[model samples]
Target: MLSIIYYFVFNIFIGDYIKYSCIVPADASFQVYRDNFIFFVKVFYYFRYFLFCFIIVIRLFYVKNKFFRWLIKKICYFA
Candidate 1:
């Protein structure tokens, strides 16, 4: 159980925390400098939202904690 929790913490929580902390500010700065908003930055912005949605969906299926599983099932059922 401890290992499972650690796996989730590192893989999901910490990874996203780092990604959002770094990428989000960079994206915002680019937006402020509208002249610098290049194709790559636009792509990165859309990709970030896409990735966030993808992660949530992927976690619903792959995360193994029983409580999370039940919560996912309830969410899916309601949806």
Candidate 2:
């Protein structure tokens, strides 16, 4: 829902650049940019998910033992 609104607002602001230029407003270029933007967004979404999962996993490990704390410390040291 938010993305749809963003797309509309974004196009409203930027559409003229593409529409008025010598470049053809063909479906191929539109789809290419659309797919690239979607892929970039998805990558960030997955990264956030991965970070959330990592935090949860670390929390669980911390709950398990002092050894896990040491392990995390070591990992952080190298990280």
By lDDT, the best candidate is 1
lDDT tens digits by residue: candidate 1, 2-78: 55765675567655554554444456556655434344445554565676676777777787888888888888899
- The alpha-carbon lDDT assigned to residue 53 of candidate 1 equals 77
* Worst lDDT 10-window in candidate 2: 13-22
TM-score for each model:
0.35, 0.47
Clashing pairs in 1: none
In Å, residue 55's CA in model 1 sits off its true spot by 2.0
lDDT of 2 by residue, 23-63 (tens): 53448758777666556555654454566567677686757
Q: How many residue pairs clash in model 1?
A: 0
After superposition of all CA atoms, the RMSD between model 1 and the true structure is 9.6
The C-alpha stretches of model 2 lying farther than 4 A from their native spots are 1-26, 57-64
